[model samples]
Target: MRRRLPAVLALPVAASVLALAAGPAAAQVETTPVPAPGNPGAPPASAPASPQPLGHAVGDAGTGLAVIRVLPNSTPTKAILPGAADKLPKQAAVELGFGLASAQANSEAYLAYEKSIAQASPGGIAVQGSSPQAPGSLAQTAPPNNEAPLTGGINPPSTPLDTLVKVGALNGSVSANWSDALGPCVDTISDASTSIASISALNAIPTLPGGKDLTGAFDAPNLDEAADNAVVEQLKNLAGPLSTLGGILGGQGSAGGGSVLSLPNTLSARSVVKLVDIPGSPNKAVQSTSTLQVAALKLLAGTPFEISINVVSQPTLQVTSTGDAATSAVQYTAPVLEVTQGGKSLGRLDAANPKLDIPISLPLPGADDLPGLGDLGKLPIVGNLLGDGSPLRDALSKDLQKLDLGVLRLAVAGLNQTGAAATQPFKGYQLGATARMVDLQVLPTEALGLPNLPSALAQVSLGEQVARAYAPEGGVVCGTASAPQAPPAPAPQGSATPQLAYTNAAYHSVPLFWTGTAMLLFGVVLVAALPTRRRKTTD
Candidate 1:
């Protein structure tokens, strides 16, 4: 209609315009980076003897945790950056460690040491008893397995931690292994050591006499100095706990097989616990900084660290009992233990994470939903994708796609961007948690070389409950538990003081006896030094 402006005429003009636009950039000469020549005198090098990290106490516990958390996934997120930020992925992580520790220099240990029981018992009773009413529940609830607190008094010990937690479902793990040594530590290098390269690395490391690696913690950026101090103290105080953890993880006492147990095993009641690795929507998060155990502390040797072999969770763990609870007059009960993961797909740490996301029904609820999802407006993801479809189908399609995290965000812009949309749920920046019942039984009856505290035991109780409750639904599977029935009441009344059912007494008892004897001698000296004759004359 407009005098046929030669359709072909536009091509030359466009080519000319493109050439002009690209001329300057194309005219520039290409340049390649020239690598500097290597010196022939430079000795052939491979790598450091100990591949070290430049870290924190538990900060190092993550093991390969840094590899997964430090890098941002290659995906689009709501908090996405414009340039380099987008190129480098973003993520966040928090650690929750449940350490069973005792005081470093416990005085009560002496009393328990010198004081003898009527019988010799080792290993607390496993908390398993038949529910008088239910047979299958026999393993579920048992009285014979019940164990009492190591320290007995009006007030029991409690854990020494202050905790904070949140929730999100993601792939994570719940592990238990004390013997597993932490990554090799450098004695010459402190957490503050700035010189990454060190020839003294090997000489810096001390020989592990106990076949255990005792080293300083990794250098971490966010960890506070006080927290580091606490970690060191925990290492010292909880040496016994660490060893116990090692044993449990190693399945030492179990005549059967292993100690690391997980839940929903879906297997026989008999078997060593396995590593339960599965994607769970716990959305559960927990954190702690407390390490004080009763009147004593358990930190020493910088901090505690351990390793792992990915294993499945075995619900049934073997409990080694020395004798009958009725005879010992001491019993124990199983406290609820759980692990979970959860998260709200919020944009970034700078913004609040999304808690609940409800997909919209079609009929075009709004422009935000699927294509022609509602009567509100056209989303046009595929250019009026459902231009001729039914509203019901549109709504159904929108909802179905949501099951996939990737589609959910696009279908609705409100979704949080922390999670990776891969097929696996655990593939995102989400939360992981562990829970255990903090009872005296869980604490080693024998302090080993460390001070034992009953107070700290109670403190960990809540943490265990929290970990156990870390469910996909974001609520405790088993609500807060009642006080454990362990260290049970005498099923048969006998006035004899129940003997302690613990091993390694002889090895750990020396220090206690030495301390007790020293006090006894001091008392004798004071009594003998008194002059009775002088007092009579003065009266």
Candidate 2:
């Protein structure tokens, strides 16, 4: 009976499968091509073309990379120490690099010293070693022993003598360390002065006097007397200050009881002894030489010396104008003067002729005309000597004529190329020129009765003016252009736009129009894969 029932069930299942298989064959089918509408004969519109890739284009203008090279225009008036001038330019080139290296070394040395002291201290130990008691540990270990007197440690180590000697040598090398440090400092100072002087000489502009005869002051009868008095006063003032400085450096007296040598006075025996006793006096030898040089310069200009002025000929002042371009013009005027130094009235010397072409860039400031005037003003009675409209200004103005200078163009070429256009940039500039007087009347106003005053004033003023003028011009020429180049024309309308191609066969093909289908399929698959829990079996 059971076998008969199984046969009956199998028969029904087989019949149902056969019926389902035959049903699909009877379904409808259509395969013929469909006909097109009215525009079927028309040609397909041409596709848009892709844009061409343009290469990089560069514009020509100020490149923002400029080189400034300042050539020496004249031999330096101040004599440099032997080999010093030759080394100056080279030293400046490497100054910053050398300074950085020195600073790094100094820092390392300081750090090493600190580490050594820490290592030598009582409780300090190597990181790798097991430390004894860490002050408040619950373990309660025994304190570290005396460290066996550091047999090979830095503190009385096996190499103690050698280490100590090395340390001593390093300590004694303070002078060497200081020398290395000061070298860059001095180079900076010298370079700064040279650059300043150069710029001043280049940009000097001559200022004209108002109604006063620029040359009359030199011809005054009391010029010699005034110069002598000025020198004496300067010498006296210098003596007191120098004495104070010498005493301080020599460690002689805290209350100042030393005889300092005056500018005009010869070096005293006592001063020589005191100077010899000073530890670092040799470094200051140049200062003494400079002082003597200053005195010499002053003496040559007639201060502290009796000098008579002889008018060789009245100066001839000429002015001319030239068209700089079609719309702009520049005018140049020069005043030429010829005068003799001695009482005898001699013809103008040929040496002074060249200076006539140089123009006065600017009048000397009143403060610079009087020697020790700045210091004198601080004193009670001496302050009265430098009152306004004093002889110092008149004397200085008169001396200016002796320089025989007028304005002359300073042609700068190298500057235009390096500034903003070249690779190596110029940080600063320098200028120099040789100046001679036709009769010494073209000298600066300070020179007339002040002795060497004209040269000093010229040195300071010429450098200042020239530097200020050229620095800006050089900056403009070197700076980057104000505007950037325009971009190329927008890419032509494209046929096939470039895009990232992705393969999407295995993954449901996410067509441009079927993004929604892909998202729906992904959510359905995720939900169907989740496990459904069955009810717990109950006994």
Candidate 3:
């Protein structure tokens, strides 16, 4: 009967090279011209000549700095074999050279080994061989034949292979376990597979021993081969939309949010008046003029707009006085036109028409015969005080400087209101204006109830309304001759009667009904959409 082997009993044999091939096979025999032991085949060809000993003078000079003699049991001395003095010195030099060369070679070998190990073990090394030294350490115990057993056993030992397999299995197991633990974490990374591939490629190339030259190693073709492999691995394992999602989220975190508003022109209060000439008047011409005064105008949006009007025909005149002759003084007079706005008026005589009057005044000279002194005749204090430059002149000049009103027509539009019913109310009405020569056209509303509506309408309408209501009454009106002058107030006993102030006609009541209804609807929708939360369990 045939005897069957259990898997465990066979594992030791099966896992090892011994099970595959019987010990010390005939093929292991060597058939080469081997070097003799005592001679070691004339010294290795690359060995150099021994350094000469220093002479007396040189030795004395080098006493402290130079190595006089190696200690008896030091590493270098013990490394030499006994009874081989003449050959020992040469052998020692050869061994020293061999050691240096071997170290460099070993450093390169170790780097390659480490790289191989990292690639094979994605997790890490699980088990290492008993010796920390590299595989080269076993070479000393082996026969001249390269097929010698590493552990010197009749049958090759299974320990090294077993350790290697165990390490490989452990690495695989750890990698799998770690993947399970970190599955959620991978979702958060934008390029998880690419990052893993990069790390693996970095770890594959081993670290060289300290002081070894590494510059040439990086240039080796093997490094490029390994990098290509890593790239292939990364491409194969790309995560589906996670990479895109992560990039989008990252970008959003870098930018923020706000609101911006741009208005066509600033809104302000102004005074306006229209003068129309009656046809066939004795003055011999039909003419019309619109005057406006803008005051205390705070800018609500951007730069304020400016307009100017030309008075078609007016003549210039000069005034002068002649005195110093005993008992006789000559005074000069000139005709002046009055311009008024908001109860403030100025009279100017000898103002040259067809010229742009900025409606502003400047300082005047003491000489009454000054050329432009005639122009000053239309100005407030300048015309009234004649030859004097008084405090009133300064005050009026300041007020005029602040009056920056563009032409009334330029700032407003002429809508065809002729057909509008006299009794109709203009609720929610919109207005627009255009200054064709100035190349500016603003439509207050193309659509109602838009966010920009309030601002647009205010730009055109606010100034127009203020101008219409507040322009000063030009000529005085007298009621029937018998109408008595308003009675003078009696002296106050303790305090005088409070004056009744006129209410502004522009102020209107806002419609609160529609606003409240819209707000209620919004609140209802918001409440309906909110998620309902359940209460926690008592247990």
CA-lDDT, candidates in order = 0.19, 0.18, 0.17
Q: For residue 210, what is the lDDT in candidate 2? A: 17
Using all chains and alpha carbons, the TM-scores for the candidates as numbered come to 0.14, 0.17, 0.12
Candidate 2: deviation at residue 62, Å?
23
Error of 3 at 270 (Å): 2.9
Off by over 4 Å in 1: 1-94, 99-314, 319-539
In candidate 3, the residue pairs with backbone N, CA or C atoms under 3 Å apart (3 or more residues apart, or in different chains) clash, namely 307-406, 347-378, 348-377, 348-378, 349-377, 349-378
lDDT per residue (tens digit) for residues 184-270 in model 1: 111110010000010000001011112223235322233455544433343333222232231212222211212212211111101
Q: Lowest summed lDDT over 10 consecutive residues: which window, candidate 3?
A: 57-66
Off by more than 4 A, model 2: 1-299, 302-330, 338-491, 498-501, 504-539
How good is model 1 by TM-score?
A: 0.14
Please provide, for model 3 over 125-150, each residue's C-alpha lDDT reduced to its tens digit, 9 standing for 90 to 100. Answer: 10111111111111111001112111
Candidate 1 to native Cα RMSD, angstroms: 36.6
Q: Give the best candidate by lDDT.
A: 1
Candidate 2 TM-score to native: 0.17
Give the winner by TM-score.
2
Model 3 lDDT on a 0 to 1 scale: 0.17
Q: Which should have the higher lDDT, number 2 or number 3?
A: 2
